[model samples]
Target: MAHRCARLCGVTALGGSMTRCVLATLLLLALPVPAWPQSAPARPVAEDPEITAALALVEARLETERIRRKIPGLSAAVVYDQQILWSKGFGFADVERRIPATPRTIYRVASITKLFTATMLMQLRDAGKVGLEDPVTRYVPELQLRSRFADSPPITLLQLATHTSGLSREAPMDYWRTLRFPAVEAMVAALTQDGERIFPPYREWKYSNVGYAILGLALSRAAGQPYFDYVEQNILRPLGMHDSGFQPTAGLATGYALPEGDAPPKPVFQPDYGGYGPATSLYTHVEDIAKFISLQFRDGPVGGNQILRGSSLREMHAAHWIQPDWQSGWGIGFRITRIGSYTAIGHGGGIQGFRTDVSLIPALKLGVAVFTNTNSDPDELTAMVLELLGPVVERAQQRSRPAPPPAPAEWRHYLGVYRTDFGSRVRIRLHEHRLEMVPAEEPAATPVVLTAIAPHQFRMQGGWASGEVLRFEVDSQGQVTGVWIGAYPARKEALPE
Candidate 1:
């Protein structure tokens, strides 16, 4: 392959401090079939030490976090290239019954629901029934809300989808203590009748739950059915997310809260979604959530149904507006977060007693979903697991990949210690006619061989640096001066030959 290093190579002591494993089983099962109707996934089985060790690290973090946060229930899953590699749960779904949590355990995934809403809207746009640039007035002519920038530009669907519409964060209604949200027509009237003036269209990024509520209303009007109905028929049923819905299902985990004072776990409060089911109402377990995530990674349905065209899904991932304070951007309904060099495009949700995070690394075809009860945050844990996972996958790929081509005789001229200071030197040496590199302090350390892809630049063949390039620098005297690996450069030692 032209880009051999791009393969999911094995893990080592990288960003996550993972231990290197020489013996790893191949992850080369045929491309997995998509998640289907009520179908349970294959049980996780890893004979590879790398995968096993990575999971052990994740389990340790999960247990510690759950105990520290006093979480009642938690569930998580790891996916790669359309396959669910690991799915597990911890703590309890019911404390009284002592029910052990599992991947199938249901939790109200919260605002991750917006991704679904965006999917439906994209579907409408794909069908030519609606346009993203069109004004909300086209669909819901009843909107009473006003904008100070009315003369500048009317709010468009794209702005709402990207959270730049300048709409209020939510509908003005009494849904909180009562648990009874206003009907769709009532919410429309609430915005329009009051003539509430918003910040200004596309002036700055401002997340608005009410704006999404308006989207659901317009989607309902455009599709000639309620948002929930359209989603169920077109998305949930086809995607086989039978356990997901706008209301709690049978056997769903009870929400709980741990207050500041000494008190038993109590039920959590509900902030009425106010007929805006798209912004929050959806509930599901990791099993079902994994199905939706797997679909997002595929270009076209390989062994399953293609929910949306791959191109459209790619369009949704494009960063539209940035949140400088957070150092992240918004991509349609997806919330972008930096995961080292990769970008995790997904969403996180926080209800009174629950917290949720769903992330996808498109470049790696990896997705992670973490759900916790009693409002524990699993974000840090999830990031740790992802960082570890990259190496694990890379290791597996390295083992399966072909060996590197031997280096030419000229390569010996570039072999030596390279560093800014001798105490912190990196050694480059010739091994079996292949160029290998390692830190000077560890002579027995696993050396990653370089594969020649150009005249002076080569990519690593294995270990942590696998697929990364090293370009040797030459001085005016035609002497090797240094080498650049990734973004870091080091000078060659000036010792006698």
Candidate 2:
């Protein structure tokens, strides 16, 4: 559980003569008062002691890890809410030229490109132009694949997005092994081979680059424009991610091979995915990816200048397939995992010479993006950043907020642990003017908000019980004795020590 700390400040009251006070009041009333902006600007970075300490730890640890791993160049960014609080780089982007890396250093993000492709597809779905359940053949009728399982269901767009399409992990062209990728027509044509389908649709979870390549073609056909143009004009331009796109821009970092023993690392060739661009071809920096992470937290309507509907974004983040271990699952374009107590949704990318990852905790509106020019795992680095920084940011945010009005004196009666007849337990607590329901077994999970609908009743605002009623049973002396949540009755119990 995240510990909450409250900060108190003292304010001094001023006294003035009645004549001066009247004049001052009149002057203030006559002048105009500007309206507050829709959203507050971000506070300056590293203002809190905890945040400063966390930043220091992150910098020291990141550099140590980079050198220990023998990476050529690496960049990272930490974003809270909608603002980037910290971003820096280490090593050299171009070792031959002796160029130092910075936050703006570009690296091939590889499979992370699927996130943008998934976003574009969700945008098309929300626009009423396509459907998640629609068959792939509906958009790309010319493409066909031979499957060993004759009874396999036709693949849907959702399957492609979630990696349940039964498609091969890569096309027969062996692009990753050969550094030479096929063109659009050639990739689609190769799908007709006898061994293209490795499994029946929905049989199991399988990561497929060919599936996303097909998805990109479908998106292009549906949007009536080139896939690159669609993503550039819609997702990239509106988010102010000017440095992000399919093509490389200035400041592109040189890719390097993993170092062995004490020998210096060797540079590796950078290759484009050609027809599989949506699956594994993207170049970007940490700063620009931070902007994309910010978009994941926004809520708005679908049309006009609004990039993608917030509802669609949530749908994309929702898990569509789960692994047998129950530790990880596949979302639309994201790999969702149970990391400690938090549910993290993000993606990792690895090409010949680059490794990248973007992990976001939407519940906290916090994210971390890491990019490396060598074959090191940036995903693990991203997790390390979160481990060192996530909590400090949370505490700092809690301390910076204006305190909520104290819970009403009588309302405190409802705050306690309650046990149902079936042996389940729940706790009710007041927070920021609302009641929160938390499971006794999972106190660290996000609590369900309960909003008052009557004097002694509340409506669950989230979770599976959302929209259900929760009523309190009060004694003659006005003390809460029990609670009825939906159809179940529970008696109040003393809290644990």
Candidate 3:
């Protein structure tokens, strides 16, 4: 008998069609039937030999950068088409104890745990257990906002997922110093009555750890299980991420290096476990995170195991709300950004002693996961990996196209002084057919290259802060009226009268 494979919403379905029964009968009579959907045209996977070399270079560069940056230990993983192509660890996981980092070294993932919490909400939605648009009061009637506007717009699960709930970055309670976990009711009372709204709901994007923590509490109530247990049963168990978990005190890498300014002393083992559990307590290894990324690429389970419904995964990865100027958007559990033509989805996390980033490029079926033990700049490591990976991916894409012409010069109209609401000013000037931006406040005065993407869109290249886009808006007189410095929204300032 012949078997057929069917696809629905990026998931594979097999052995359920009527044709399979007919094929079985025909095989008994020694007759051949038509091929099934499994025989459909196969998509060619793009490969770049340079990727291997580029990854090697990236490994070496990361090692050098870690030392130069004073990062004690780090681990990284790269995946192509849902397959982990490389996973390596460098430096010392615990500098004092002289323990080297490995793929299994556990590091605090910080707010990346928000992604997992958001995914849990999506799963509940798929099971008809909850609705994304449901107000927070539905699950936790005590949940409230410090502002009256909280009742006006009515914070929903969707808003929390995308950070549009207008909640402050944290609750009024000093969870870290208190070191005591508050009951959901107590937390809700504090947030509703004492928490101050930093901005109007949906008016802007402000990353909020409190928003996600609220969602986690709601999910826990809806599932009738502890938050960690629900995530373990629904997400980790099915995905086979055995090395990933909450609490994270047992399996942590020994001799973990501590940052400079924190209290308790250097090389302190068993760091304080504050009350910030739902938003920052997750501890995971590179290999386990690689598995999670693979599941994202497949939009299903790992190793042919179906964990999440394909439609649910799509909803999770889809852009929920875009920031002004389309710099980036927030998906349910991911951040969507365009690199050239490919849309990458992922999130970055940071805490006292760890920094992590995970991104998946579905068009290319490639994923990048980076974890560092020492508290340092995560953006720098992520940029280096992207720089090394971008060219290799582009070369592979070139194979399926014709050689393109060089981009035209785009530095004439946007040279001016731009001011930001945060009391920062940037001076942009044209130099040798290129644009240079110098922060007015910095003393070094190093000129950074700005590559123009469109009429008003540009990116800073080849500097400490690379890959950030700068967009300019012009008025009727062709004067620069507004400028968006980075992923944040653009703030327009009036020209001098």
Candidate 4:
């Protein structure tokens, strides 16, 4: 069981007037408002010393870890309910320029932007402009697929949102290297002509950026607005996310540190993808993302008005599909997981030089958003934040529910041999009930323990890859057939008996 700190942190209250004063003070000092309240909440008025100490420890450890990992800079925030408990920036935002990361520094959120895309789709559903079950071909008739399976089933908007559209993780050709903002029409055409369905649509779950790119195009067609413009009007503006948008204009911090020894970070070349972003290109500061997190908590509003209906939020939180092993489930737009007795809903994002994590615990009316400008591991940081805030959230729950036991062993039955079409076979074995994948002919392969997520689904720990859920399929005889690993594009072929 992951240890939860028992220390209680006294809560502090900042009135709306006082918050305004603080903002004014920050503006005068030219310092960023690291902490800002999205809305006032009734809670204990004293800051918890123990909680503060724990948080300090976490911050210190993160700084050390960043240096040790060769990560150049980081900016992070923590929120509870709608209140900003704490936010801070560490290291250099621009290593070459010696500029420190600040609350105002904007970082590429990568796939975390997908949540916004999904939320926009939900908003369209609320407005009766789009249906979740509507066929993709309905909006974009030119959409096609290489395989009959990909084209025959008639992909739905929901499938694209949830990544069951049978599209590859990315386009067959390297769009990142070849093109700058290739037309959606060209992308769909290329996918239709060259893409192969690694798995049958809706038969399993696979994470696909192509799916989201298609969804972005479909949403634009449905709304009769450019993708970024539609999101700005419907989602960003209404959410009061002034600091959040698809592109970073002048005044935003730049020259962020790239991963050491990794590819050097370059300026975003394509204005179309960066400017007309959807799915994976939104830029945001930590405090703004906290506001978004609070809105997700419970009955909170977008732009001080309820934009998503209560039913819609519930549908967003409800499990949309069960993974193959049945250990964890995925909701409409969020990845669902239970840590200890608390249920968490949110997503994690990774780009070249940044990592972002947002988690919401509605039962406690609490949420957390952590953003870093340096590409480093977020798992430990997330665990620490949750640990610091755990006691307070538990107190709010009003019930002493013991931590849930680790997932059961039947979930491990899917562990076996898998062969890739490239004549490579890998063996997934159970060690201490955790799945360890070993590639054949690799003598010293480091094994990544597959953390039980839902049913036959599991995710690897550490970094941006932690939130991905791997699903395994079975034959009629209940033997493992093939496995579709989420995040990565390739599927693992089951080895012959």
Candidate 5:
């Protein structure tokens, strides 16, 4: 029968129905049918319906503001977790050529450059080659600026990173007005002769571009490499920010001075920061900036390079010096700002005709970057984005957050009331797959979480007993009898039917 069906299938391929013949042959021989290969399902995008709706609202607001402010061109992006949720541009990169601005349109990012310098310094600090408490003079002994207060402590690297170094705000030259920045050696020499410490070290937070310039020079000396080289090799390249550079480069958007009244916008000539590049000389686009923003959201590598440690990034985000207003402060290289219930850490930049702002909301793992060709407060755009998109992403995260893993089957043996030797009673309950110790008297209070570290040992989270080891005592029958919380014994109560 198989031979006859095989011959029938071959004959049908020449004229008759081949599908029917093949089916008959397979049935006769009872051969398994081969399956066609299936293509993989499409990956889910980061933007969901809620996020899309919020993005529409954000786009409307951005367009309205871009026109109202008379910005020639601008770019903006929103990052959630480790992904860029949305990015776009408005107006024209070159109004004369009618070139439309896009997320790839490059612009001078100004003071945002300080963040790169800060990250490099933090990397060196974490590598144990330099100490945060080390004096600035240790690296730059050629620095001869004088302090008015004799009792003031010598300036430290921490003070420099936090903007409390008491250094002058500029490089002791008319660089901003002249647009002719000095070289590193000449700038340091001029500063030594003309500059004076504005305030005692750590006395107050005084923003000093020259302080960061000095820091970069000192960092170079400590790392035994050029400052820009260190940052480029360790940070920009590792983060794959190839479009970013400290000099004028291709794809740069023409910057325009803020137009006066109805007069046409005047294009401003771009200038290089020279020795002060570390503080305000970065030229980049929204796409590369998005990569940097994603770095702030997680600790792992990007394209196989670990830019900075997660703990160090957290330290950089923490407030090192707070302003008198209580709403603003300075982190290592970031600006700490408070908006209602949210705490944002990032930086703002403005030089000549360009303006930019970046804000990272650590709690939500969300960030926003706004870049404009013409001078304007990009921070306003950032605030609106956070207000509009932040809540939606946060709620979505809460909804999508995976449920806790199922409790172990053996966990039931440890659940019950425990009477401590000190006459205190605590109840161990399995709530939401977590082992929590609830006070018997105040069950309404927040319970302390217990995390399993071994077969019968757990660690307590929070309270005065944080980090203390907890061991469950088991009987020969494998039933839990009591628990030992750092040598303090607690007897378990009998289970009721």
Candidate 6:
């Protein structure tokens, strides 16, 4: 257009065709170019104002709770989506010396060690050296324990994995207070001589430290290395959990116990399970345990090391045995529970002086580990942390993205008050292009915003209402009917004419 104008005005004759062409090129360069389509701004990093703020409050409340519980010291680490969001400690790890505990502070992990022992066995299983169905006697024949059943079904590796083996809970003595762990040879000798069963083999779920002891012996024999050595080399070292092991080391957190009747916290020796070390002797801090937890969430090799087969890892997290009236069930080594709608699988340990717990949420890729020098229930602390983390993480994961897809515009006819038969009233309202279900009776309750996961099927994206699917029921006349929240149906309140 510029060239045509210049030619009509006789600029080509005034200068030359070459000059006119040059002028047109310069004019085009000087004109402002419109940025018609610019790239979108960077999405906020998931961990920002909200996640960090909630975490700060979480830390403060937990510290206060620690003092209230009279816990000598506690170290905690929270992992979200494969990264440790934060790790902190409260109170004195060593009361007499006033040494502060830290997330790196090593404490006896106790029964949580069973998971690692189970990991070694799973490794052997992956290597094709052993089978889960193989009998315990096949490897550890020294355990000449008998069964009461007529066709005595031998206690298999599966039984030991699920804690259903009819082995005694402890060794013949009260070794907990004594801290005198017998050698593997001595434990085996006493197996046939004095060992007894609390229940018959494969009868029921009975947690047995001695059962794991024999299982460890079998694992060690199958791996052709000592139990501790095999676990350290294969599971711990490969996963970069160098600070984790089965022995008490220098600078390790001093174990403390409250002398009966409100006495001040006193130091206690870290218990050695002797031959049963795999069941209860492992010592590690929160950070290392978090790493180990991360590995459990990862089904494949991480950082160039493959510890267990992916199929085996899924098996480890599976709820194989469920107990009556229990909130959770037993997996291969992990104790599986529900943290709201999320499935958390891990283990907890309570030794003489220390209490520890580790929980991993595979769906959210989050893990929490708590270690206490005092014998408070670490699982409770971990559960508290998970409850605090659940909503905050859900918000973080859903941050600053495009809004949830809108429900059909005409569906507003169904948006009204919904009442369950149990008298729980919910107000269903469309907000920000999604369905929000708010418990109308509770002023303090957070509304659960739901998203469609399938055709006409919505899952609660946040709050306590999570995992509840709202499938709208349409009548033959195309009028909206009640929606099923669970077993109960929430009938929609009629709109005013």
Error of 5 at 300 (Å): 5.7
Model 5 Cα RMSD, Å? 15.0
What is each predicted model's overall lDDT from 0 to 1?
A: 0.75, 0.81, 0.70, 0.66, 0.81, 0.76
CA RMSD of all predictions: 11.9, 12.2, 19.7, 17.7, 15.0, 18.9
Q: Which candidate, 1 or 2, would have the higher lDDT against the true structure? A: 2
Cα lDDT tens digits, model 5, 192-285, are 8987888997777889888888888889999999887888889988888999887778888889999889887788887767888788888899
lDDT of 3 by residue, 1-497 (tens): 12232221111222244334333332332332222233334223234445555665566556656655667788888877657778888877776677788877888888888888888887788778999999987988877565645445678889888998777777788765655656556666887787767777788887887777778888888999989898888888777888888866555754334445443224533444343556777889888888788777665432344566666778888888898999789899798887656778888887666778887777667788888875677555665566557656655554534323343544445656667777777777765456777775673588887776877888877556688887787789876677777754444443322
**Best of the two (3, 6) by TM-score:** 6
TM-score: which candidate is best? 2
If the candidates were sorted by their lDDT against the true structure, best first, what order would they fall in?
5, 2, 6, 1, 3, 4
Candidate 5: pairs in clash: none
Candidate 1: where is the Cα deviation over 4 Å?
Answer: 1-48, 269-274, 301-304, 403-497
lDDT of 2: 0.81
**Candidate 5, overall lDDT?**
0.81
Q: Is candidate 2 or 3 superior in lDDT?
A: 2
TM-score of each: 0.71, 0.81, 0.66, 0.66, 0.80, 0.72
Of candidate 1, the 10-residue stretch with the lowest lDDT total is: 17-26
Name the runs in model 6 displaced over 4 angstroms: 1-46, 174-177, 259-263, 301-303, 400-497
Model 2 lDDT per residue over 32-98, tens place: 4332232544343346555665665566557767876888888999887678878999999988888
Model 4 TM-score? 0.66
* Span of ten consecutive residues with least summed lDDT in model 2: 2-11
Off by over 4 Å in 5: 1-48, 127-129, 300-303, 324-326, 405-427, 437-453, 456-497
